[model samples]
Target: MALGMLKKKRDSKMSTDQENENEQNGNQQNGNQQNGNGEDKEKQGGGPPKPVGFLDPRMKHVRRSVAGKWLLTTVVLMIFILGVLSIYWACLFHVDQNLSSLVVYVVDFDGQVAPYNTSGVTPLVGPMITDMARSMVASNEPTLGWGPLPPSAFDYDPIKVRQAVYDFDAWAAIIINPNATALLYSAVQNGNTSYDPLGALQLVYIDSRDDTIWYDFMAPFMSSFMTNAQSSIGSAWTRQILQAASTNTTLLSNIAAVPQALSPAIGFSEYNLRPFYPYQVIPAVTVGLIYLIILSFFSFAFYLPVWMQYLKPEGHPPLKFHQLVVVRWCGTILAYLFLSLAYSLISLAFQINFSGGNPVSSSTEVTSTVDGNLNPDAYGKGTFPVYWMLNFVGMIALGLACENVAMVVGQPWTGLWLIFWVITNVSTSFYDITIEPRFYYWGYAWPLHSVVEGSRHILFGLHSRIGLDFGILIAWAAVNTALFPFAFMFMMYKNKHHLHEYWA
Candidate 1:
């Protein structure tokens, strides 16, 4: 009985101790939960984590990483490209609508006067004269207006026409000499081979001196006039040929071979006077932009070393020769890609008309038409693959050359900036002068001009007159590629002292 009581007391004591231990553990766990909540609340109140600085351990994975820079560059480039595309769309729409509003002037110099019965001319003469004048004016659609001027209108004065042309009062003027019709008939009758039938009647004169404004006005009007003239000449010759042939079969066949009215064996099939302003102006602007891009890339490339130097005050440990070479080539490639993309986007945005089709969408179409003749679709059906390929290669070569030169200059930032300013000024001045006597001299010496002109030829089949442009571009590339290895060697040789100092 005593042993049983002892056992029950021991068991009761053990159960009480176990319950106390459980309560203590629960209290500790609750305290830990409270601490965790406090920490989380503190973190939320402190706000988002601050960015790691350059020297921070967290930034070890962030600074100068290829992936990070590439991503940043790509995002920026895509935005630029989208902007450019929008610009091109807008430009195309604007041109389509505004093209028709361009003004044109017509000048008639034919001096055939309206006949008068009191002046002893036949009664039919007045009507004939009026009819011819009306017909000449009527040829164009939306017939402007026509009326006779007093004899005083001629006055045989040169000043009137000159003043009118200068004042923009008339787009063109026709000063018809009084004896023009008589002269035409007399020449035809006398078998004078030198007789001009239209006898200055359609003597189309334009103010070629006002290049910018005049060309814009003249292009469409001249295009229309040429079309009309060709039709009229063809019809008249056909009729005269048939009339002559009616008398004799042999004579008709001979006349067909050598038509009396149509002395020329060949006739003009087509002529397109549509001013290619977009084509010309866009390329020029692109050339200027290309120079700016190249110079900027070089400036950046050159600045890289200075930045790295600043980061490592003691002097950077020399990279292995091969590694250095690899870095240089890679940087150059990257710069080229960046600049090319930038240029393309800008051009598209500005709606600068390029002759080639879109490279991305592969949309190539035969858009050019000369007179009424349809030229064979020579352009590629898709984005001009060959052109883009050539352009890429050429552009890379040019970029490499610029990079090498910058390295040689030792202070690329300054050198490139100076070169850019000089080239820009010279190019602007060269274009300003109407007569470019020294075009050959200057164009050959300037690489940018040569590259631009050459690229135009390769892509759009334009401005191939500069003889050595292609050769020069190829030569520049070859020279630069060869120099790249030497440049690496030179940098290694030059930096040997620094390397020795660091290693020592």
Candidate 2:
């Protein structure tokens, strides 16, 4: 019984040890499986799963849905860039093709029929000037189109000529003094220095705002005209003097009979009606920079709320539509004022001074005397404040319009379209909208063009259409301001209807 009892105890102890070993082995296997799973998960989530190339191969929809969005954006941007380039080239081509169609006005104050005229014709020298101008402009060699103003346009007054130029009746004024012939004859025959060729010269008043007209057309044509006239007059006078010195009465009488042959007398002067201010680049660059700033401001304003909502979830409730409008107006006014102040300082750096007073001459007299020519001058005195105010209001209107566009579009991409519009309207910068192609003529309605025109009118004393421009700008501002509330309502409706699914 003792041996049997000892054997039972040994068997029971061996059985217990075997069970313990089995449990240890199972636990080790389970731990190994868990480690393997953890390593697999790390590899899948944190490491590159495949070789890098154009796109990842392991992702759902090529890593994420945003990848598709990125691809679409790249393609669309490339297309837009190409389209903008094509439009710019088209504008250049348009300008090149239509240059000959530009019209100019001719004022012939240089009327003198001639001394010893035989046919009992009026010795008005204006007809001669007009005829010569017409003949030149009618040529097929890409000359500017010339239109001769009637004598009824002005009564031989130099001040009236300046006023006409200011009123945009013509691009330039050509004035021939009443005694132009007499002065030329005296200068040639008696070597009289009183009729200084340059001082007592025929007067040409030009709008110097556009260098193309002055340098390309007026300067060249007038120079050649003067040279030819002087040569012809000098030759005729020399022939007559030689004949008179030889006591050749028959030859002298013959020459005197053709005294009208000396009608190509030369003496001319030019007055720049709106002289190019030395710092014209300042105004131009200022406008462009301000436009860019306004654009950036509107773009930022549009997105800032979204960013705020994300970053400051508990900071404040969503801004109300009226609050947003008020904020935008205040921001726009402040931004424009700051930028304008900076622009004024920049102008001073370039020595561009602005003053206040009447820009036009007090006297409206046209005198044949040398000192009596009307002052072809620029008046920027009282005009600066008007121009600055117009530009300020214009910028504000443009900003509000852009902001309204962003709100109505309700897409971040509206910023890109706004940029495209601004670039396209730049055709107004170099060429007059009237001369630009039909495609670009829409720039006349653009807000920036009105601002540029108003600036030019006040700065350079152009024929100002400020009132019309102001009306347009104010109308745009008012309409856009009214549209903002509607845009907010639409955005709210969209968020409630379309975006609710994502929130849910």
Candidate 3:
């Protein structure tokens, strides 16, 4: 009994001490409340994530892991962009130097022992013009391959030279009329006011073939050449007139009769065989076409989920692998068909005269000048359908490659592939491959090149490589089709073998 009582007294004292201790703790906490709060050091969130120093030992493995990923990403991006994307820049290299690929025919019909030159006067104009043109080829400057075709080459027919320009055999033709010297002599002697100097030379080119090349490179150079040649010929002709005037008093009267010829002796009659009339169509062929690839590539992302529903293990039984591949091809193609139509409609909406204008009765009828010169469509009224079908084939050619690459390379890297794809296509397709480096000759076989060429044929009536273009694009689609199953099968293997996980 004594021991139990002692134990009770001690227990009661201990409880009182415990309560006092609790009260003291509460008072201390209330005092701490005055100073923000009685918080442990960790409750402050350890002051956001610190900029870890290079040598800091804490989380060494974690930092190393992050560093490795960053390094990998940096290296991969640099190598991919610099190494792969550099191909585009390389394609454009030495374009100015390689401009000889753009052939410009220089035909001299002036008094060259031709039926064209019945003029008794010696062939001064044609020789002078031909010499001037040929001299350019001998110079150090970069210029078009001035192939001087003899008048006989075109059967001494100036109209045939224009036909050659229309045929796309030559980018341009500088023709000196056979009777140029004869007419000039007559004008000087008779003071014929109707002697238009523009009749002497014909500068024939087609602007619609590749307007950018024409405007940027060819036009400027040709203009400069023509200007220089005019000045040269003008001075030479003045000397010839003075010499003839010195020969006879009658000839001196002729010089006074046609004093106006002393100033503006000659001029070039420029004929743009097929003009790129509407400026609005520029986007359809150029930068806008890049979006075609963008649309086709990202269509996978846009409609992937819907397509994936069929592949899912949930609700319905999954589609067979082969069926899924077929579905992807068919769906992608159908989507492109509609997408391409939508794209083509934008051009039509702006009234890009898809209606076949009056067809040229002869090749000589085509010209840029507005003498009722309609910008005729190559395919007539069927242009829109052909255009839309081209876009469809283009999409298939381009998008299927994207799909195949995406399957092979997978995400994050696929975006890089997109850059590569866009750059190569733009470099080769939008720009003239003829003027580009030989490295880009392979681009002729590329899908976008074919698409662009076909578009130009359909829209601008440049050249009818449509059959060849379509063949190239179809070949691409067929080749991609051949490889489609393998690429998709690889993707399936990755899924089945759990190669890529947690992606959804």
Candidate 4:
């Protein structure tokens, strides 16, 4: 009976101890669950994590890696320094130095099929003009290279001549009229020293689009050439006229005796194709406005995806990557289109006509100084709506290109900013690249260059490469659009595999 009572007591004690241990374990597990919930709430409800300096939390991997930090610093420094140097100092230097290398189109239509006089005297003016250009090169001063066009080029009308200038084949073109020699010879033969009978020397030049650069460095170059040409022509003409006068007493008494009428045989007249709207410097304004649209479009395209990711609510259906891409394209186009439309409206309200035309009629009375042709139908019809629409298309292309760059770099803000700065430097907005060392022309292939060039053509009546410009813009847009999806997928793969963990 004693042994049975002892066994019962021991079993009851063992059962109580086992129950206590189980209860303690259960309580500890509940406490751990509550703590985990608290931590998760802090992470989810508290908003974005704090940034480390200028970098976001997502960029933590790059911040930690030494090589990555070095690369970032170097790139930032390089961009800052290079952009400043290229835009400000290098451009100024190039404009000052490389002007001598430019070619001036010398289309001499003044050549007489036969001698201008009955005395068997050929004018020989063309050789004289060419000799003067060659002499300039020998002098070692910044001089022009005379590029003689074919005789058939003389038959090209005013519109074709303007198109040639727009194509950048010539800094300036001199279309010597048939009157150059014939009229001068008549004055000498008639012994009429009353006024210059040869008429004014017409210089066809495009005006400066900007205040600083002076028409892609055309002003300085043409100015120098004109000075040299005038001097050479005066000296040669004096010698020729005096020689003729010495032979004929009547001609000598009328011209050689009268020193006051010994002025230059040719009066200079400059005819600018892009005349301003009364007084405003609006050609550059158009360029600035277009660039602003591009910048705005880029800002919108770059930030929209990130904003969508962050601002979207929890219950809302998660946007697919493809959906994001579609949104990007549509949003970019709409944003730029609105911007362009707004500018067009403002321009219209102010009567700021980019396309040179009279408000009342499509055609205006314009007298041609070159050929002295008078036509009532001198102007083409103004097309404002077409230009505005094209501006919208161009803006979309620029935005798409910027977005593609952002996707490839995996950082929207930084990538686009750097790209803009670089493009601005390359653009002739600040400096003419023709003046640059080695004549750097890589930027000519860029969309912005095409847009600026095309816009000038639109503003003026030169429709030389309008089709080519739009084609380039569309091609670039397509290339960028195709690149975006691939870049996004590659970036996602890297993130998933933690491949960028070392240096994101």
* Prediction RMSDs, each to the true structure: 16.8, 7.8, 6.4, 10.0
Models ranked on TM-score:
3, 2, 4, 1
Candidate 2 segments exceeding 4 Å error: 1-40, 43-75, 112-128, 188-191, 199-203, 206-208, 211-265, 280-319, 357-384, 408-415, 488-504
Question: Candidate 4's residue-wise lDDT over 143-256, tens digit each?
Answer: 555566644674534345545654556656665554566566656666565656235255665453332445545566667666776666667777888887777888876675
How many angstroms is residue 6 displaced in model 1 relative to the true structure, after the best TM-score fit? 99
User: Evaluated with lDDT, which candidate comes out highest?
Assistant: 3
lDDT of predicted model 2: 0.56
Mind giving the per-residue lDDT tens digits that candidate 1 earns over 59-117?
55556596788898788667755654443233223332233333322222234343321
Could you tell me which 10 consecutive residues in candidate 1 have the lowest summed lDDT? Answer: 265-274
The candidate scoring highest on TM-score is: 3
- Candidate 2's error at 320, in angstroms? 3.9
Off by over 4 Å in 3: 1-58, 113-118, 247-249, 358-361, 368-374, 497-504
Which lDDT value does model 2 have at 383?
A: 47
- Give TM per candidate: 0.38, 0.70, 0.85, 0.66
Evaluation by lDDT, superior candidate among 1 and 3: 3
Question: Model 2, range 1-504, lDDT digits (tens) per residue?
Answer: 999999999999999999999999987886576454544544656864334455534344555778788999999989988887566566656544455445556665444323423333343344556676677667755455566665457765556766776576656656655555455444444545344544334444443345544565556656675575456555655665565647766545544554433433355566665555444443443345445435534644655465335323386644444565466556656776665655545544554445523344432222121332222223445544664567667766676666666656766677676766566656555456544577877778777767666665655555668788898778877887687656655655655633232231
